[model samples]
Each structure stands twice: as C-alpha cells, then as structure tokens.
Target chain A: MRNLHTDEIIKNIKEMCIEANYKLASDVEERVRGAYDQEATALGKQILGQLAENLDIASEDSIPICQDTGMAIIFIKLGQDVHIEGMDLEDAVNEGIRQGYEEGYLRKSVVGDPLIRINTKDNTPGIIHYEIVAGDRVEITVAPKGFGSENMSRVYMLKPSDGVEGVKRAVLETVKLAGPNACPPIVVGVGIGGSFEKCAVLSKKALTRSMDTSSPIEHIRELEDELLLEINQLGIGPGGFGGKVTALGVNIETYPTHIAGLPVAINICCHVNRHVSRVL
Target chain B: MDQYINTPLTMDKVKGLQAGDYVYITGTIYTARDAAHQRMYQAMEEGKEIPFDLKDSILYYLGPTPAREGQVIGSAGPTTSSRMDKYTPLLLDNGLKGMIGKGKRSKEVVESMVKNKAVYFAAVGGAGALLSKKIKASKVIAYDDLGTEAIRELYVEDFPVIVVIDSKGNNLYEIVLQSS
Candidate 1:
C-alpha cells in the first residue's frame, strides 16, 4: 500500500486550486479557438475571439478569469489501496480550499445560511464529493462553478415512455428558458438516467470531459450534434449579442435508470470553464 | 459603431447611445451588487441621501475578488444583471444613468432607461482578469460590511464595454435572441 502524507495532499490541493483559477487549461483554450473558427456568424466569431483574448490576459497576469471565481468544488476518486497518513482526508481538502482562496485572492462568495445570508471570510469547507474506486492512485478534480449558468441548471423526472424525444425536448426547453441569462455560446452538459441527485452529478461530471471528444454512446453522440446545431440556431450570440452561435458545444452522459422513471438533468457552464485535475 | 466619449457620463451622453455600439468608458464609476444596492435603496426609501451622487454616474454590477499585494483590484468583472433587476428601476428613478454588467435586464429597467435617458452596458462576464487592468484604483465608499458586495469608488481608464440597452429602449439581448 502506498502511504500519502496528509500535509502533502493538503499542499497539492492548495496549489491545484490556485493554478486552476489563474490559468485556462490548454485543452479548453484550443477548444475555444476551434469554436472561433467553426462559428458561422460574424458576431459569434467575434465573441469567441474576445474569449480567447480574455484567457490570454488572465493567464499572463496570474489572475482569475471570472470575478465570481466560484465555490471551490472538488471531486475525489480515492484509491482503496492507498492510505492517508498525516491528517483527515476531508480536513486536508478543506485546508487546501481555505488557503487557495485566501492566497490566490479569490472571492469568498460562500454564505453561512442559504436563507439569511452571512459571508464566510475565506471560501472554506469546499463542497467535496468523493467516490471510492479500485486503484493505487487518488485522482482529484476542481471546478469553479459560477452563479450565472448554475442558476439556469435544471432536472426533470420524466416518464419512462417519454424516451429520447423527452430528453431532447427538456434540454431544448432548458436552454430556451435560459436564453441570454446563462451567457450565450455556453456549453451544455446533459445527464440522462440515474436518480435526481446522481443525474445532476453526471451532468457536472460530463462537463469535465475534453470538449473535443465525442460521446461514447452512438445515439447520444447523434443527439449531441443535433442539439448543438439547434442551440446555436437560437441565435444567442456572444455575450448574448445578436449572432449565429448560441452554444459552443453539447455533451451528454448517461447511466441505467430506475425501471419506473427516466431522469434527465442539464448543467450549463459559462465560457470561463474553470476546472483542473491531479493524480496522487 | 457609435461612441460615447469621456466619462462621469451625463444623461445626454448616455441617451445618445444605441444598441450594437462599442463603447470605451473612462473616468470614475462606482461598484455595487445585490446587497449594497438593497441597503442604499433602503436608505433612499427612508428618504436619506445615498453614499454617492447618482446623477450622471455609471454603476458597475460587480463583486470583485480581493486584491493581491500591490494590486488596486483583483479579477474585477461584471455579474449577472438579472439578479439586480429588482432594485434597478428604483436607482434609475433616482438619477442613475448607466449600468455595466452581463445577462438580461427587466423590461421595466429598459423602460426606465428610455424614460430617464439612461444606457446599459455589458462587460464580458468571464474576462475579470483582463478587465482589472483597466481599473487604476478602488476604495470602498460604503457598506464595507457587505464584503465583496460593498460599494466602491473606482477610477477606470478605457474600460471596454458594449452598449447593450440604449435610451431608446432597444435591448441587445432581445435582439440577439430574436435573430438566433
């Protein structure tokens, strides 16, 4: 068994948080450039161009790409064979989050109460989601979820008979309702099957995939292409300006559903697309 | 393609703007979001004076991250305008002339812009770091207790934005969605 020191994990987590917020991943940058080329409308092309510029400026300056900087959302895939040596695993993750937000100068947007809000000085106690898997190495992913697109996310419990068309309709309706509010030329992450909460997880997880990769399921792949075409047709251009491209891409993930219901969820992500991962 | 030159922009300057124009704003602006606006408007509701003069002034809907060493401001960019839509008309009625933020605004606010000769601008939502370069200095003027949501006096130079809603009640969001 490989023993990982708690201090080491905490240190790595802090660095990962700072690095992810400061820099746009190369894969994300390349995909934005690719979208700029494929964008059919002049306005859409311009919007993507500006996005590319934003990334460049943020990276060079070592600052966050978006003001929201988001809540520090961490997903952990723990290896059963490995042992956490120095500190509680959860404590290590939270310490990393606290240090990152404070050291990186990122905003502390988290509030004490969802109802009667009170500010937490440092963005602490990250919303950590963990999954245990058979392996020797632990994997971690950090996604900074901004409020705009997160506000537009939705989940629907559909009748099993509703089938594929139901899923498409729900996805389209969500985007349409979102309109310019989610930020145009956005990325749409759709999760089909699973329970309500699990479906939401699947939707967010779907967003972590490389933007250039296609869905493994053939039917879902075709659905993604069709939806991408349809979403762009909505004409919500860059920054919600009049343009030809409404969305940059559509990605879908699925799992077996309960025999009684077909569940679907949609997670909308803004252009900042801030997320980073590490293996330990 | 039209321009609104200079800053501390008057109603005359803002009213002249129309949708689809790119604007370079320079000079002084104040920052406020949900909390500060609510508090200020509440003061106004109680017939008390606001912290700053609203007439001919532009308000940026942003809650910037804390600044690092030697930096005037951190990644300072706009937040969603729709979240502040509830309190905006009241501010507009009290001499607010311009707003800078992303996402859609209420029809009532657009009507207020048309009625009061104001303009609405949009700064790129995710381009916080790039936008921070335009801010020369920032000092909290009111509601420091609100943390990031505090009201601030900011000096900006050539701050890039697009005229999203003009005095004529033209809305770029409506136009864009229609065309799409």
Candidate 2:
C-alpha cells in the first residue's frame, strides 16, 4: 500500500485550487482561439478578439479568469492501495481549500445554508465528489463553477422512447435558453443514461474530457456534432453578437441506465472554463 | 474610429450619445449585484440617500474574485444583466446613466433606456483577470459587509466595453438575436 502523508496532500490541494482558479486550461483556450478564427460576424469576431486579449492579460497578470471565481468543487479519485497518514483525507482536502482561498485571494462563494444564505468564509467545505479507484495514486481535480452558466444547467428524465432525439433536444434547449448568459461560444457537456443525480454527476464529469477529443460512441459523436451545428444556428455567437460559432464543442458521456428511464443532464461552461487536476 | 472616453459619465453626456458609438470608460465606477441592488433600492424607497450617487455614474453588475497580494482587484467580469432588470428602472429614474455588464437586458429595461436616454455597455464576461488590469484602484464604498457583492469605486483607465444598448433604444441584443 502506498501511504500519502497529510502534509503533501494539503500542499497539493492548495496549489491545485489556486492554479485552477488562475489559469484557463490550454485545451479550452485553444478551442476559443479556433472559434475566433471560424467566427464570421464582424461584431462576433471582435468579441472573440477581446476574449483572446483578455485571456492573455489574465495569464500575464496572474489574476483569475473570471470574477465569479465560483464555489470550489473538488473531485477526488482515491486509489484503493493508498492510505492517508496523520489526517482524514476529507479534512486535509478542506484544509487545503481553506488555505488556497485565503492565500490565493479567490472569493468565497459558498454559503452555509442554501436557504439562509450565510457565506462560509474561505470557501471552506468544498463540494467534494469522491470515487475510489483501483490504483496507488490519489488524484484531485478542482473545477470552479460560475453562477451564470451553472444556473443555466439542466437535467431531464425522459421516457426511454425519447431516445437520442430527446437528448439532443435537451442539449440544444439548454444552449438556446442560456444564449448569451452562459457566455457564448460555450462548451456543452452532456451526461446520458444514468440515474437523476448520477446523470448530474456524469454531466460535470464530462466537462473534464479533453477539448480536442470527441465522444467514442459514434452515435454520441454524431449527436455532439449535430447539436453543435444546431446551437450555432441559433446565432448566439461570441457574446451573442451573432455568428457561426455559438458553441465550441458538445461532449457527451453515457453510462448504463435503468430499462425504463432515459436521463439527460447538461453542465454548461463559459469560455473561461478553468479546471486543473493533480495527483498526490 | 472615434474613441470618446468619460472618466465619470455625466447624465447629460450619456443622454446625448447615439447608438454604435465607441466609449472607453475611465476613473471611478461602482460594483454591485443582485443582493446589493435590492438593499440599495429598498433604501431609496424609504427616502433614504443611496450609498453612492446614481446620477451619471456606471454600475458594474459583478461579484469579483478576491484580490491577490498587491493587486487592486481580482478577476472582475460582468454577470448577466437580465437578472438585475427589475431593479434597473428604479436606478434610471434616479439619474443612473449607464450599466456595464454582459448579456441581454429585459424589454422593460430597453424601454427605460429609450425613455431615459441611458445606455448599456457590454464588458467582456469571463475576462475578469484581463479586465482587472485596467483598474488602477478599488475601494469598497458601500455594503462592505456584503463581501464581493459590496458596492466599490474602481478607478479604471481605457476600460474596454461595447455599447450594446444606446440612448435611442437601439438594442444590440434585439438586433443580433432577431436578424442573426
């Protein structure tokens, strides 16, 4: 069994939180640049130019990509053969989060209660989703979710008869409703074939996929391409100015669902899709 | 390209501008969002003086990330404008000149824009880090207790923005959405 010390885990999580908030993943950045090249609308193209310039300034200045530094969402893939020493894994993760937000100067957007709306300073008690995997390495991913795009996300439980068409409709509708609000030329991550909550999980998980990669399933790939074209046809271009590039890509991840249900969920992210992963 | 920049936008100047003109903003602007807007407006209803002057001033609907060391502000990008639609007309009536944020405004706000001769500018959303570079200084002016939602006076220079809704009620959102 590989033993991971508490200090190392804390340090790794702390750095990951800060780095994830500050940098735009290269894959996402490259896609935005590609979209800029393909965009036709003069106004839309201008907006893309500004977006590109903004990305440069962000990286050079070492500031966050967006003001909605967002609530901390930590995904942990704990290796079965790994054991944490000196501290509970969750506690270490939370501690790292506390230090990261405080030291890195990222906003603390998490509230103590959904109803009462009391903020938990330091962005503590991150929204952690854990999966135990067969390995000797523990992996952590921090993806901060902004409110505008997050509010536009959706989940649907369709009758199995609806099938692929149903999934396409949900994905397109999400983009349509989101329009400019989700920050156009957005990324669409679709989660299919899971239970309701699991579908939501899969949708977020799908966002972690490499931007240059496509879904392996040919039908799903077709769905992704079709949805991307249909959404751009809506003319919600860069900043909704009107152009050919409304969505950068549509990524779909599917799992086996119950015989009676077809569940679909979409986790939409803006142009500044910032996330990072680290192994400790 | 005619570049007209006003440090502190005056209502008269704002009311005079037409659609499709470029304006680079500078100097002080306030930051506020949903919760802060509600409280400020509620105070206005009670006949209380607002925390800051609304006349001829720009209010950026943003909740910024925390500032790193030696930095005046953090990644400060615009939130969606429609969410604040309900409260905008109230501020317009009180002499607010312009709004700086991204996304579309409500039909009601556009109507108010026409009637009041106001303008809405689109600051690049999700470009907080880059945008913050233009802000030379920042100080919380009101609702300091509100954390990121607090109203702040940010001193900026050549802060880039596009005029989305102009004084004539020529809404870029409507124009683009319908024709495109």
Candidate 3:
C-alpha cells in the first residue's frame, strides 16, 4: 500500500481553498462569457459584463470574487491501497481550511453553532465527504459553497408514478422561486433516483461537473438540454432583470433508488460557481 | 439611462425614479443585514437610540468581507432583501428613506415604502468586487461583535444600482414580469 502524508493533504487543501476563491474556473468563465454574448437585454448584457470583469479583477488582484467566500466543502476520493499518516484525515482538512481562509484573506463565514450563531472565526470544520476508490492516488476537490444559493436548494421525494415530468417540474419551480435572489444566470444541478439525503448530495456533486460536460447517458443528457432551454425561457435572465440567459448550464446526476420512490433534489449555484480539484 | 444621485434621498428625488431606472448613488449610506436588523429593531422597540441618524438615510442590506490592507473595503454587495422584510417597515416609519438590496421585497415592505415615500434599489447580485470599488470608506458603526453583520457607515461614490421599487409602489420586478 502506498503511504500518503497528512501534511501533503493539508497543504493541498489550503492552496485549493485560496485558488478556488481567487480564480473562476476556466470552464465557468467560458460559460459566463458565452451567456454574455447570447444575452439579449441591455441590462442583462451589462450585468454579465460586470460579472466577467469581477472575475478578472479577482484573479489579477488576488482578491475574492465575492464577499461571501463561502463555507469550505471538501470532497475526497481516497485510494483503497493508500494509508494516511501523520494526522487524522478530517482534522487535517479542517486545519487546512482554517489556515487557508485566514492567510488568503477570504471571509470566514462559518458559525460554530447554527441556532446560537457565533462566527467560527477561522472557518473550520469543513463539510467533508470521502469515498474509497480503486487507484493508488488521492483526488481532492474543494468547493466553496455560498449560502445564497444553498438556501434556495430543494429536495423532494416523488411518488413512483411522478417520473421525469415531476423531476422537471421540481427543478423549474426551484429556479423560479430562487428568482434573482440566488444570482442568475445560475447553474442548475439536479440529482435523481437516490434516497432523500443522498439525492441532495448528488445534486451538489453535480455542481462540480464542468459546464461543457454532459451526462454520459443519452436520455439523461437530453433531459439536461431540455431543462436548460426551459430555464432560460423563464426569462428570469441575468440578475433576474430579464434576458435569454437565465442559466449558463443544467447538470444532472443520478443514482439507483428503492422501487417505491423517485427522489430528486435541485441544488442551485450562483454565477460565481467556485471549485477546484487536485490529485496527489 | 444612468442617473447620478446623492443619498439622504428626498421624496421628490424618489418620486422622479421609476421602476428600472439605473442609478449611481454617492455620499453616505448605512449597512445592515439580518443580525444588525434584528438588534436595531429590538433597540427601537426598547426606545433606545440607534447608532446613526435615521432621517433621510439609506440602508444597504449587505455584509461585506473584511477589507485587506491598502483597500477601503473588500467585495461588498447586496444580500437577499426578503430576509429583512420583517424589520423594514419599522425602519421606514422612522424616516429610513431608501434601501438597496436584491430580490423581491415583501408586499408589506412595498406598501410601507409607498406609505412612507421611500424607495428600493437593487445592485447587481454577485458583482461584489466591482461594487466594492465604489466604496470610498467604511467603518463599523455598531454591533462590532457581529463581525461582517455589524452595522457599517459607508461613504460610497457612484455606487451603481437600479431603482427596483418606487414610492408609488411601482416594482421593477413586476415590470420585468409584465414586459417579458
């Protein structure tokens, strides 16, 4: 078994956090530019232009793209043949986030307690998800999820008979309800067929997928395209002012579920959809 | 059509604005979000003095990131306005003449704007870095313990916004819906 040092993991996580906040991933940037070119309304075009400029400034100045740098979400794919050394995996990840937010001058948005509501100060205890995979190298992805869109996400457990139409309706409704609040032109991430909680996780995972990538399954890919078209037709547009580019992309992820249920979740992401991955 | 206006908005100035007019505001505005609003509303109920003067003042629903060295402020942008709907009418009654935020305001809040001759403006959401460039200066005016949620007094220069709701209850959101 290949032995991996915890220090390496922590170092990578810290860099990922800082870089993801400072740089809009190239795919996301390209999609936003595409939307800017396609947008019809004057206001929509102006707003999209500003968003592009903001990203450029953030990269040039090493500043955050948005004030809400968001809570750190770490997704880990640990190789089954590798053993972690030097520290506990979760502790290492949180320490990385604490150092990253503090040193990068990113906002520390986490609160220690939900109801009591005290800032965590250093943005610790990153939400971490781990999976053991077949390879010997570890893959880590850091996604800084801002609450504006997170609060707008929805999950529904549909009856077996509701089918694809129900999934479509739920996604459209979530986007409509989000309106301008969640920041259009938004990214729509749809998760289907899992249990309730798993479906929500799947939807979030869908957000990390590249905007240019489509689902490998033919029918699922078609659904994504259809949803993208319908969402834009909502005329929620850029910043919800009114235009033809309400959403830059629609991504859908699915998993098997029990025979009686058709669970679905919609996780909306704002235009500043920030995430980065590293393999070590 | 972009219009330049100064803060401490007057009824005539507000009346001149219609739904969808792009505006650039200069001068002072107060910043408050969920926590600060709750505290301010509670203080108002207790008859305690608020930290800043209220008459003809504009409040921005925002919680900016801490400014780095050599910067007046970090990325500062409007938050979702609906969360502040509960406490907005109270502030409006006390002469808060304008608010800057994003999203649809509550019907009650819109009515309060109409009754009080106030107005609502929306800055572009997710354009914080661009917006921060307009803030000339900022200082925590109250609730420093709340971190980003503290009430701040900001001096802004040509901060861009769109008039979303006017004193007469004309809402830009509704206008967009109808026209589309």
Candidate 4:
C-alpha cells in the first residue's frame, strides 16, 4: 500500500483554500461570461459587468473575490489502498484551514457556539466529507460557501406521489423565495432521492460539480436543462434586478432512496461560487 | 445618469432620491452589522451614547476581511441586509438618513423608512473587490471586540449603490418582482 502523510494533506488544503478564494473555478467563470452576453436588462448587464470586473480584480491583486471568504468545505476522495500517517486526518484538515485563513487574510466566520456566537478566530473545524475509493490517489475539492444563498437553501420531504412535478415546484419556490437575495445569476445545486440529511449533503456536493458538466444519469440530465430554462424564465436576472439570465447553471445529483420517501434539497450559491479541486 | 451624492445624507436629500436611481456616494459612512447593531440598539434603549453620530448618518451593513499589508482594507462589500431588520427601524427613528446593504428588508423596516424619511441602498452583493477600491479610508470606531462585525468609520469616494427603497417607502425590489 502506498503511504501518505497528513502534512501533504495539510499543505494542499491550505493552498487550495487560498486558490479557491482568489480564483473561481473556470467553469463558473465561463458561465458568468456567457450570462453577461445573454443578459437583457441594462441594470442587470451593468451588475454582471461589475461582477466580472470584481473577478478580475480578485485574481490580479491576489485578494479574495468577496469579503465573506466563507467557511472551509473540503471533500476528500481517499483510496482504500493508501495508508495515512501523522496526526488524525480531521485535525490535520482543520490545521490546513487555520493556516489558510490566517495566511491568506480570509475572514474567520465560524462561531464556537450557536447561542454564545464567539468567533473561532482561526476559522478552524471545517465541514469535511470523505469517500473511500479503489485507487491509491487522493482527490480533494475545496468550496468556500457564502451564507447569503445558504440561508435561502431548502429541503423538501415529498411523498412518493409528488414525483418530478413536486421536485420542480419545490425548486421554483425556493428560487422565487430567494429572488434578489441569493445574488442572482445564481448557481443552483439540487439533490434528489435520498434521506433528508443525505440529500442535504448531496445538494452541497452538487455545487462542486463543474457548471458545464451534466449528471451522467440520462433523465437527470434532461431535468437539469429543463430546470435551467424554467429558472431563467423567472426573470430574477443578475443581482435580481429583472432580466433573462437568472441562474448561471443548474446541477442535479441523485441517489437511491427508500420506497416511501422522495427527499429533495436545494443548495443555492452566489455568482462568486468559489470552488477548487486538486489530486495527489 | 448616476447621481453623485455626498454622505451625511439629510431627509431633504434622501427625499429627492427615487427608487431605482443609481448613486455614487462620497464622504463619510459607518459600518455595522449583526453584533454591532445589537450593541448599538441596546445602548439606544438604555439611553446611552453610541460611538458615532446618529443624526443624518449612513450605516453600511458590512463585515469585511482584515486588510493585507499596505492595503487600505480587504475585500469590503455589503452583507445581507435582511438580517439587520430587527434593529433597523430603531436606527431610522434616531436620525439615520440611509443604509447601505444587500437584499430585502422587512415590512416594518420599510414602514420605518417612510416615517423617518430615509432611503435603503444596495451595493451589488459579492462585488467586494470592486467595492473596496472606493473606500479610501477605514477605521474601526467601536466594538473592536466584535472583530469583522465592528463599527468602522469609512471615507469613501464615488461608492456605487442603487436605491432599493426610497424615503416615501417606494420600493425597487417590489417593482422588479412584480414585473418579472
């Protein structure tokens, strides 16, 4: 078995955090560029132009794209053939986040307690998700999530009878409710067919997928396209000022579910949907 | 044409503004968000002095990242304004002329704006890097303990914003939503 050190993980995570904040993923950038060209309203176009300019400034100057550098979210695909050595994996990951936030001058938004609400200072204790694979290589993805859209996210526990129409209704309702709030020209990540919490996690995972990529599942792919058209038709526009391009892209992910339930979760993200991935 | 406005915005100036007007504001403004708002509201309730002047003042709902070396401030932009809805009416009642933030405010906050003759402005959310260049200077005025959420007095030059809700409670977001 190939051996991997936590130090390597720590180093990569730290750099990935900085890179994700400074430069948005290319897929997201491309979609925003495409949206800018297609947007109809003058106000919406101006807002989109400013957003594009903001992206340029962020990378050129080596500062974050948005001030809310967001909580660290890491997804790891660890190979079962690889053996990890050094500190506990979780602590090592948190160490990476601490160093990243400190060194990169990213905001420390985490609170130690829900009620007391004290800043953790170091931006530690990241939300990490792991999956074991067959190969010896490890793949890591970092997506720093801003809360403006996170607060607008929703989960629906529909009966089996609800079906695709129910899913459409739920997603449309969430987007309408989000309106100007989710930072329109938003990226919508949708998860379908799982337990409640599982679907929620899946929705967040969906946001990591490249905007140009569609789900491998045939029916799900069609659903993604249809939803994208329907959402833009809502005229939420860029910055929700009313125009044609409401969402940059819609990504849907699904898993097998229990016979009785059809759970759906919608995780919305702003124009600055910061995500970066690396493999080692 | 974008209206060029100077801060310390009065009721008369605010009244002249209309919903959907693009404005570039210069001069002085203060930053305060969740924690700072709570403290300031409690102080107002107890009849204690707030850190900054209340009359004709503008408060921006922002919580910026720490400045890097040689930088005036880090990527600074507007945060979600709806979160501050709880304390907004009180601030409006106390001679506040305008607020800078993103997203929708509550019905009560809008009503308070009508009564107090204040306007609510929104800078494009997530445009922090572009927005920071306009803030020529920034100094934390009070509540340093609140970290990023602290009250920072800022001198801005041509800060871009759109009037979302005007003094008479005319709303830009409402019209956009209806038309859509």
Best by lDDT: 4
Q: Give the per-residue lDDT digits (tens) of candidate 1, residues B1-180.
A: 846477777866876688888888889999999889888878999999999999888999999988878889999988888888889889888888899998878888888878888889998777788889999999999989899999999999889888888888888878766665
lDDT of 1 at B37: 84
Ranking by lDDT: 4, 3, 1, 2
The TM-scores, one per candidate, come to: 0.96, 0.94, 0.98, 0.99
Model 2 scores what on Cα lDDT? Answer: 0.83
Q: Against the true structure, what is every candidate's RMSD? A: 1.7, 2.0, 1.0, 0.9
Per-candidate DockQ vs. reference = 0.77, 0.73, 0.75, 0.82
What clash pairs does model 2 have? none
**Alpha-carbon runs more than 4 Å astray in model 2:** B1-3, B15-20
lDDT of 2 by residue, B1-180 (tens): 235677567756676565545567877888899879989889999999998888778888988887777988888889988889999998998888889988878888988878877889887778777788888999998888778888888888988888888888887766777887
Model 4: pairs clashing at backbone N, Cα or C within 3 Å: none
Clash pairs of candidate 1? A234-B180, A235-B180
Per-residue lDDT of A51 in model 1 = 76
- Candidate 4 per-residue lDDT, tens place, A1-280, comes to 9999999999999999999998888899888777778988899989999999999998887668999999898999999999999999999999999999999999999999879999889987799999999999999999999998899999999999999999999999999999888888899999998899999999999999988799999999999999999999997788877899889889999999999999999999998888888898
- TM-score for the first chain in candidate 2 comes to 0.97
Using lDDT as the measure, name the better of candidate 1 and candidate 3. 3
Reference-based TM-score, model 3: 0.98
What range of 10 consecutive residues in model 4 chain B has the weakest lDDT sum? B7-16
Any idea what lDDT model 3 has?
0.90
